[model samples]
Target: MYGVQINDDGTIEQMNDELAQACVNGLKNLEIHNYPQPINMEVSLLSIFCGFYGTSNETISAEGIGNIRKFNKLSANADKNYGQASSNGERKPNPWILTKILRYHNKDHYEQIIKPLLKKNYEGKKKEKQIQINQTLILNKIDLTDDFTQLDMQEKAANGEYEKEEQIVMDLTRILIYYEGETEDIYAIKGYDAICDTQVLYHKLEGTVYKQLEKININFKNKKIDEKDNSKPITVKHIFKKYASKFFKKRCKFISEDPKILTVFQGYKYKKLHTIDYECLQMYFYLIKETIAAGDERVYEYILNWIAWLIQNPGKNRELQQYYKVDKVQVKIDSLM
Candidate 1:
C-alpha cells in the first residue's frame, strides 16, 4: 500500500516508478460521474494525498479516511520535543521551525524542476546550497513564486537570511550621521518617545525594508541628590548645575569624531551593544544653534542624561559605535552562474 514491493525472499524495496505508472493507469481507467477523465495539471496536491491515503490499508474505512489529516493522541507522551537552548541558556523554539522543515523538501522539488526545465541554461549542473541556487535563480528565466512577497522573511531568517542586530547597528552608524535642520519646519525633524526615547537610535535596511532597533526597559532612574532629590524629572537648569560634566567630559568620545574609542572590552572580546546610539559633537553644535527649551540648556540636559546612563551602569560604557570600515557581510556575494 505504501508503494513498496515485497520479494519472495522476505525483503522489501521501493517501487516508485511502477507505482507512478500504475497511478497514471488507474486514473486513466476510472470514470467519474459516468464520464472518462484524464489526469492533468489540475490535479491538486491534496487530491493526490487523498488518493494515497485512501489506498492505505489503515485508512480504507470511511471514518478513517475522514480523520486521515487529523492529529491524534494529543498528550504529553505524543508531544515531540523540539528546539534547542538559546544564547541565554533557555530552551525555546522559534515559532516557525516546523514550517521551515517542510520548506527543506522544497529544495528537492526545486532541483528536480531545475534539471528538466532550466538544465540547458544553467549548463545542466545543480547547485548544492541555496546560496549557490540563488545564482541560477536570478537569471529570470522563470517566476515560479506565486508573488514577489512569497519569500517569507521570518522563515528565511531561520535559514540564515538575517544578521545579528548588534552587527547591523554598527554597520548603519558608519554610513549616516544625524543632522538636525537649522530651524523648526525644515529638512530633518527629530522625533522622540518620552518613555523609550533616549538621546540616540539606530536603523537597519535590507532592500526596501527598514527596521529600527532600540534598547528597552533601561534603568532610567536618575541619581539622588542628597537624599531629598527623589527621582522626579529635573529641569535643564537643574541638569546643568550637577552630574553633567563630572560623569561625562573625558567620556564624551561618543560625540567625538571617532566613536570606536568607547569599545569596552570584556575578558576576550568587546561587549555587544545592540541598540543604543549616541549624539555626536557636530549634532551638538547643530542642536545648540537651533535652540530649544530655555536656550541650548535642553540639549545639554539630554546629553547629560545619556552620559549618566553610561556612567552609572558600569555595563554600558563601551566605545562609540564602530561603523568605520564597511563590513564584508554586506558587500560580499557569491559569483553566480
Candidate 2:
C-alpha cells in the first residue's frame, strides 16, 4: 500500500508505503515512523496521488515515475545554485526552504511570508501600471510649468513609481548634480554654521578673540616649564576655565529647549562635528540624498557648516578622497552659495 500528498501544481509533497520501503531499504526499520512527529519520505507517489484524485482517468505509469526523478534532479540543481547543497550533494536546509516549510507547517508563518511578498509584488505592479496610465504626466507637467518645482518632480517620481533601473540611477545622479549639486545644502549649511557659531561663542565667552593664539603660548610655556623643573605651568587652569565656561554655556542653551527636537538637533550637531572630516561630510550627503529621495523633510541648521568642512578638508583622510577634493568642494559650495 502506498499513500501520497500532492499540491495542485503536480509537485510531490509527501509519500509513504511500498515505495518508501524500497527507497529507505525497509520502512519498518526506519526510526522516523515511531517518532512523535510525522516524517517525510521521498517518492514519486505525489503526482500519482494527484492523478488518482483528479477527474481524469489518467493512471500513473513508468513515465510518471521518470518525471518525478527529473523534478528531484532539477530541485537538486536549484539548491546547488543557491549554495544550499552540501559537498556530499545533499540538499541542506536554508532560509528559503525553511521559509517554505514554515509556511506549510504554520498558518502564522504562511501569512507572514505570503502577506509581505504579495503586498510588495502587487504594489510594484500597481505602480508600474500607474506609470503607464499617466504616461504623459511628466510631459504635461513640463509643458504647464517653465521650471519643475520639487513638488512637481516628487509627484512625477511617485507616479513614475517604476523601480529604479540602473540607467535611471545614472540619470538621477546626473540630474541631481546638474541643478542641485553633488553635495546637500542643508547638511553643509548646518555643519558649517554650527562649528563657526560654537567657535565664536567660545571666543566671546573667553573674553579674547585670539583664544587659539593664547592657547598656543600656554602650551609652549607648559612644555618649557615641564622641561626645566618638572612643574606643569599654572596656565592650564586658566585655559581649562575659559573653555569650561563656554562648554557650560552651550550646555545651558541646549538644555533650555524642549527635550525633543532641540535635544536631537544638539546631539546630531555634536556627533557631526566630533569627527568633522571629508568622509563624514560625504556620508552626511549620502544620508541627505536618501532622505530627500524618500520625501522626508527635516532640515537642520548644521548643514551649512558641513559644506564648509567639505570645502576645507577636501580629501586628506587615510582612505580615498578624490571625489571630495578642493575642486569638487569649491563646485559644491558655489552651487549652495
The models' CA-based lDDT, in order, is 0.27, 0.29
What's the lDDT for residue 282 in model 2? Answer: 81
**Candidate 2: misplaced stretches above 4 Å?**
1-99, 106-149, 165-168, 178-337
Q: Which candidate is the best by lDDT?
A: 2
The per-prediction tally of clashing pairs is 4, 20
True lDDT of residue 257, candidate 2:
42
For candidate 1, write residues 280-332 as lDDT tens digits: 45676555334321234444455456556665554444344312112222211
